[model samples]
Target: MATRVNVTVDAHLAIEVMLLTGTRNPQDAVELIVRDYLERAQRTEARTGDADDGRRSSDLQPYQPPQG
Candidate 1:
């Protein structure tokens, strides 16, 4: 399920996101951006181990987010 909400964003950032993501709809662009952000966070957590504890097993390396 999705919730409906209104948000205000900078005009330049909105247009840039639209062009970069090839999304004409503002909502779609925002969703894509948010999804990517969440994915990156999850990936980081998986690589780095528990963030609160700050304890990591020697087997795992630091998380490096993907670059375009």
Candidate 2:
């Protein structure tokens, strides 16, 4: 079973986002936005050395820096 959610958004922005994403379903759009938000939050936390449960993006070896 899926839960129904109500969200308010800017009408103009919604149209532009829908066009750019090529997804007609509002849920798809919302999922895309939420995915982006989570990714940015995770990266921000990683940059700040916010170790979660003694694990972070660096601990997972997910990022590689250039070496000279």
Candidate 3:
């Protein structure tokens, strides 16, 4: 069983989340918002991939002018 947590947030913020999620229950709205945020983050990470994938400035070559 998952543990239940109690949180206190500003009423206006909660209302906004409720409206966005189209839920009447504050708990459901908050849960949906958190879940959506995590999913988006994961999707972004998958699309962009790891920052350390390893191309560096030292790997670049200086540009040369063409001979006429």
Candidate 4:
């Protein structure tokens, strides 16, 4: 089951998210972002056996936005 949500974001940020996720629809872009975030958080928690601290591991580099 899926829930409907109403959200507001900066247009430029939305556009960037859409491009980054290769999603043409704004809703899809938002869903993709949320899913990715949740999955990453779960993985981090599992690896550290603690709540996600929002810190990348030393072995992992920060993600950079794609260059045009």
Tell me, by TM-score, which candidate is best. 3
Q: Which stretches of candidate 1 lie over 4 Å from their true place?
A: 54-68
> How many clashes show up per model?
0, 0, 0, 0
Candidate 2, residues 1-68, lDDT tens digits: the string is 97968888887777777777788976688678888999999999778765565755545765678989
* TM-scores of the models, in the order given: 0.71, 0.52, 0.72, 0.68
Models sorted by TM-score, best on top: 3, 1, 4, 2
Q: Write one digit per residue (lDDT tens) for candidate 1, span 38-58.
A: 999999988877856745455
Alpha-carbon local distance difference test for all models: 0.86, 0.77, 0.90, 0.86
Instruction: After superposing candidate 2 on the true structure, give the runs of residues whose Cα lies further than 4 Å from its correct spot.
Output: 1-3, 51-68
Q: What is the per-residue lDDT of model 3 for residues 1-68, given as tens digits with 9 covering 90 to 100?
A: 99999999899999999999999999999999999999999999789776676554556789989989
Colliding residue pairs in candidate 1: none
The C-alpha stretches of model 4 lying farther than 4 A from their native spots are 51-68
Q: Estimate the TM-score for candidate 4.
A: 0.68
Better of 2 and 3 by lDDT: 3
lDDT of 2: 0.77
Cα lDDT of model 4 by residue, 1-68, tens digit: 86887999889999999999998988889889999999999998787875356554655888999999
lDDT of 2 at 16: 73
